[model samples]
Target: MDLLEDYRRATFFFESGDPLGAARLLEPIVEAEPHNTAVRLLLARAYFNSAQLNGAEAQLRVLVEHDPSDHYAHHVLGRTLERAGRFREALPHLRLASAMKTQTDYQEALRRVETWLGKNSAA
Candidate 1:
């Protein structure tokens, strides 16, 4: 199968709530296609699910820089930033995520960002 197909399968596993399976499936593909944005982004999501926050953030940084208006990228990037204690950096991405869609997850993430921002501002 092609790398893109492999990546798509990995995403299917991830969406089905098997992130470890997705990560396991994506590990080799990432080595083979390091510059593949979709693979990198999917790998980042798997990493986040597996608690590999640093790895997730690294991949997302590349992804967001390559395409700034990738709302999902910014959403994941916001989650990664918040986990890293970079609350300020997470705010804009979270806000963008919220503005880009009306999903419950995005709204929840945005709410978390706002709470963090409030605390930060008060400090």
Candidate 2:
């Protein structure tokens, strides 16, 4: 199989809003080129978009481990955890991502997680 062609098609599928299709195409590419950060990130994004939270968390964890300073990876991991109702676990990652960068979304996620934890803790 042509990896480049597959990557392009996967990207197309992702951009076309068929995240499951993108994920299906990306799985093999990620397996073939595990070190390709871009491919892995895209694959993680596809998983997240497709509501495959576990898949997204796995890929994002690898990305974070490979590069601790990857703000986006941390942010996505936190988001995945939050979506899966693991708010407490998502806190540190969201905080780290917010600290690493001043992106609005990152800060917003951090705040949302904190709120969830607060409300739940008060229960």
Q: Which candidate number maximizes lDDT?
A: 2
* Model 1 poorest ten-residue lDDT run: 114-123
- Tens digit of per-residue lDDT, candidate 1, span 25-122: 89889889877887888889999988888888888888989888889999999999888888888889988878987789888988887887787796
Q: In order, what lDDT does every prediction score?
A: 0.86, 0.96
Q: Candidate 2: worst 10 consecutive residues by lDDT?
A: 114-123
Instruction: Estimate, for each residue in 36-95, the C-alpha lDDT of model 2 and write its tens digit.
Output: 999999999999999999999999999999999999999999999999999988999999
- Model 2, TM vs. native: 0.97
Prediction-by-prediction clash tally: 0, 0
User: All candidates: CA RMSD in angstroms?
Assistant: 2.7, 0.9
Cα lDDT of model 1 overall? 0.86
Error of 1 at 60 (Å): 0.6
lDDT measured at residue 74 in model 2 versus the true structure, 0 to 100? 97
